[model samples]
Target: MRVPTLQTSRQTLDAISTRQAEQARLQNRIASGLRVQSPGDDPAAAAQAELARSRLAHIAQDQRATQLAASVLTTADGALAQGTDLLQAARETLVAAGNGGYNLVDRQALALQLRNTREQLLKLANSGDGAGGYVFGGQGSPVAPLTGTMTPTYDPAAGTQRVGENADYEATVDGEAVFMNIPQGNGVFATSSAPANTGTGWIGAGSVVDAARLTGHDYAVTIGGTAAAPTYTVTDTTAGTAVASNVTFSDGAVIEIDGQRVQIHGKPAPGDSFGLAPAGRQSVFATLDQAIALLEGNPTNAAYNQGLERVHASLDRALDGVVLARAHVGEALRGVDAGSASNQQETLSVTTRRSGLEDLDLAEAISQLQNSQVATEAALRTYASTARKSLFDLLG
Candidate 1:
């Protein structure tokens, strides 16, 4: 009987201790405001919370990357905008120089202004991002890509940065594309009348009306016959040798040779030659230098007119390059904004999911904690009463 009594007491003590532990756990949950403190409490919910947290961390990292990309693109865009304005100023100067009334003094003044403009462009080309790297530097060259006023040198390689998951962006504009790579005229061929031509002969802007027929070679139209029966012949001077010989010429004649159509106007004197060559790449810096030289050279009226036309063509191409760079920058900015929006939405969803898995309901938790406290107190009181009542007391 005594053994059974002792066993019952021991069972009552174990019950009280278990109830006390339950009460303490409830209190901890209420204080911490987390229902699932460990995976042991709710394995599935804990795993879900961990996954959400991991996704949120990734989102944060990508958001930072997007912000960095946006900053670089913004800087590049601003630089390109300033470059456009500088080109416009150069164009305006060229126009002023083109005026018939402008004399040597006026031309010199314009050249000085152009020199200043070129300096500004160079500065823009070598702009930095306030960091160790250059804004326009393609791959972080050891030195500036464009230097020297008379003959600038550009040597750069392409470089890119990351903005999002599997999304890499070009933050640096291709300086070579902007400064050195420009198709001369019509992206095919360029035409120019000889400066020594005394006749009223003029070469209109030639076009690559046909690509297949074009030999991609330079040609010259030389006048040989008398003025009464003036004859023009097309010669491919690719290797100082004539490919097409003795082609007939007439006033206002449209001649198609090597896939290009060129219109000839006015008369051509003996030995007068008009040139045609494949449109090739030329640097904007070199173009500016050449323009300055032409303005200072004080060539004859006809020569000056021809030089002005060439300058206009080069300026147009450079402007196009600047516009293209700006467009690319705009696209990058839009992408960053879209990515930012996506990241925000993802962060919201993750936070909501994690909250669902881990957040506690204060009202429900408080009610359960109170109930557990009552049970714990009841168990303790019963155990105390049972312990006090010994065998002798029970028998009496």
Candidate 2:
């Protein structure tokens, strides 16, 4: 078959142009150190590289989240440590106050020390995590977990209120556990009780009762019996008469039978009596408060000494709560560390895969560029020499 002369020249020029374009592309890849600069260069490789890069980005984001979570938990743990110390100091102060020999002046001095401890505890409770939010307040931003005076009133109950996410991450601490779990005074009674009026000479009655002597055994007490303003009366079964003795009231009021003063509450009636015994919830704070009052020369009355014992018991419970909180913080810190490590590993893996798919091998790329350049040069030379030679020239 005879070749077309015109087509031959055109074909040579087209071949040279294609070779030059390829050489330029290869050179660019070598300079940039990228095998797949565009999807046109290697469609399958480009797709794989994109997927790997996306996975790496996600891993990085996860690592950041883990870091922030760890920071917040660490702040909380530090605050709890301070709280534990304050609680311990308060326990010791209460023990000192329970000593019977301390006079009114000595007791008042002890109350001042207790008040200082309470202030420190409040500061700890209100501690913040670098970010303007309280550590113990959970997800409730900007609100302190505990504040103001602690009081007891059944109707107007008060205590730490939870206001945050219930997820394990948010529930890293329990505010109520830290502030309200004191021995004998954890109930609504402690929260809602009215303050003692000094002028009225009445001190607040804590739920706990002090140990005292009883005149009648296996007897009953009735308050406000038979009269319009009837009240409690103690009856002696052996004597078959009203003893009117050895009964005490929670408010430091006493009654007299023979020469001995007995505690009584309200108005007394015939055959109405209550068994004398120690009573109160086991609480750490209540015990401390009682000790403070006793040290301040405030009458703990019959219930004061019993309150000191409860304070000691409450301390153990509070310490346990603090330990649990610390453990939770430690666990969260571990989890954060683990998550960060996982994210770093995942990121490294994704980056490696991405580099394999998208990065150019410099040695191979340089060889390809040289080969393409030689092909382009050879095509240009061939096209220039052959296109200029006509059929007549060939015959000559």
Candidate 3:
């Protein structure tokens, strides 16, 4: 009889303890608002929730990436804008330098102004990301990739920073393309007057008339007749061959050679020559620097005019490069915005999925908790009443 009583008591106590544990679990679920606290709670649901959480984390990371890219790109865009304005100011100074009414002193003042512009432009080119990194630092850049000297130097990286590997979403513009890799002279070739010439002739910026006919070789134009009836000859200095000889020289005449066309203005003395060569990369800084040097030498009226024209063409191209860069940055900002929107949407979807997997229903949990509490109280009362009863009374 005693052994049977001990077994009965142990069984009742186990039942009561189980009910209490269940009530406590319900209370915890209500307070914490999560149904699956551990994998053991609901293994499948917990696993799925973990996956959703991981996806959400990735979405968050992507959002951060796009945000960072937008910031860097905005900085680059603003710098390029300022750069454009500085280049415009420099162009205006070049125009002023060309003024015949402006004496050497006046042009020198313009040169000083141009020097400041060049410095400002250089500063813009090397603009930072506000975190000790270059905003225009393509793939990689040193602390200061571009030198700050009057003759700025740099070998800009090839590719820009980006938010994704295959994405066209660039975080920064290619500094090389914007500031260094600009076409010199015309897009095809450059022209220059011979330094030793005693003529008042100026070489205009040439253009490509026939791409197929261009030899991509250097050529020299030599004037060889009396001033009254001047004649010209074209020699391929690169190939040491005469392309044209004894061509009639006319003032402000177009001299087309091997597919390149340039105009000559003003009188030319015999032996006055001009040079033409394939276009190469001319940095905006170099262009400005050369323009600054234009007035340093007491050049002839013709030489000053020639230098002025060349500088103007380069400045035009420089301005175009900056505008194009700014446009590119704008496109990148739009891309970032699109990416950000997509990321936010994904985050919302994932959050919903994760919540469904692990989140508790407050109303259901509260009702379950109340029922559990009642059941636990009844179990304790029953166990206490049974414990007080004697074995002999139960047997009777």
Judging by TM-score against the true structure, name the best candidate.
3
lDDT of each: 0.80, 0.57, 0.84
- Weakest 10 consecutive residues of candidate 1 by summed lDDT: 160-169
TM-score of each: 0.85, 0.65, 0.86
Higher-TM-score candidate of 1 and 2: 1
Q: Which candidate is the best by lDDT?
A: 3
Candidate 2 local lDDT, residue 56: 77
Q: Which of candidates 1 and 2 is the stronger one according to lDDT?
A: 1
Decreasing TM-score order of the candidates: 3, 1, 2
What would the per-residue lDDT of candidate 3 be over residues 1-396, giving only the tens digit for each residue?
A: 342488888888888788778878888888889999999999999999999988887777778788788889989888988998898888888877777898888888888998889878888888999877898777867677687586677755667877752454677678888898898776678898988998888889988888899888999999999999999999999999999999999998888897789998999899999899887878998888788888666777888888889888888888988899899889889999988888888888889989999999999988887887888788778877777776687788
lDDT of 2 by residue, 1-396 (tens): 223377777887788888878888877887888989999878999999999987777776666667656777788788878777877776677667667788778768878988787667667766776776666664354566555556421211232222112222332355555556543332212211013211222212233222244332333333433434344455554556775633333434654332223333333333333332222343234545655655655543434443444444555566667777778778877877777777778888888888899899999878877888888788788767765676677677
On a 0 to 1 TM-score scale, where does candidate 1 land against the true structure? 0.85
Q: What C-alpha RMSD separates each model from the true structure? A: 3.5, 10.4, 3.3
